[model samples]
Target: MATTALFFLFAGFAIACAVSMVYHRNPLYSAISLVGVFIALSCIYITLAAPFIAAVQILIYAGAIMVLVVFVIMLLNLEDDKPLNRLRYLYAVGGGLGLILLVQTFFIFYAVMRAPKQTVDADVTVGKTLSIGTAMYTEYLLPVEIVGILLLMAVIGGVILARRLEQPKLELVVDNELERRGEGEIKDEFRIRL
Candidate 1:
């Protein structure tokens, strides 16, 4: 009962933080809310007895990913967004979608809560980091290599797209006569030629 209560509490907090993260106009505030959501998700993972996933959630998502997001936010020096009045219709759409998601979540949670719980014999190698690494390298090697190649291509594409092309400079060299000529005289000469 206590575990279930704690799970629900964390889940609710996670959902609230996620909503705040999406709705906040300020990037920094949104990132901070995302951290809260990650923390809440980690707590939920712990309650589910997946300590490895919980630790990864804290270390990778909450710590490393959040730090990267904050650093990018700081580097970009983002300003506060404009008032939502201009996007009032978007707000209505978002609110309707949020309501639909909430209903779906409630139904899903209710179904999960009512389902029969099954116990499995814990395997020594099941959740170990080493076993996971081994499996990835051995069984999933081809997919991993493909993903790496795709990422490399994406990086190359990004670099190519981001590079700035140098514009050719235009220089005009005038003779002594032309240099001495006034702007009105030059215009008169061009008009006569035309």
Candidate 2:
């Protein structure tokens, strides 16, 4: 009963944080809410007896990914572009979808509660980090290496794109005759200083 209650609490918190992440106008606030969602998800994973997954969720998604997102947000320095009224239709559609999902979740939980409990297999080693690592290295090595290479390429591309281009400086020139005549204004006399 206590575990069930804790699961519901974390689930609700995750949902609320997800909603806040979507609804918040400020990007920083949205990112922070997303971090909260990640934490709540980590808690849920812990309750599911997957401590390795929970730790990875906290370390990878909550730690590395969120830090990258926040860094991007700060680097871009974005502002709210669209007015609330402009997104009214989007909000309506999202709300409708959320309502449908809530109803579905309610029915699913009710059905689960009505179902008979089953014993968990003691021989299952699915959630263990060692088993997962073995599977990844043996079965999914190629895909993992491909993803790593893609990430490396993306980093290289980002660096290349962010590099600043060098431009020639502009120089202002004044005529000595104009200076002697008290008309020293350098009108149309500016040129690129090579």
User: What lDDT would each prediction earn against the true structure?
Assistant: 0.81, 0.84
- How many Å off is the CA of 101 in candidate 2? 4.9
Top candidate when judged by lDDT against the true structure: 2
> lDDT tens digits, residues 38-100, model 2?
999989877777778899989999899999999999999989645576667997898899899
Predicted candidate 1 versus true structure: per-residue lDDT over 40-133, tens digit per residue: 9989877766677789889999889799899999999999877766767997898899899889999999999999997754454344566667
What is the alpha-carbon lDDT of model 2 when measured against the actual structure? 0.84
Itemize residue pairs with steric clashes in candidate 2.
none
Clashes of each: 0, 0
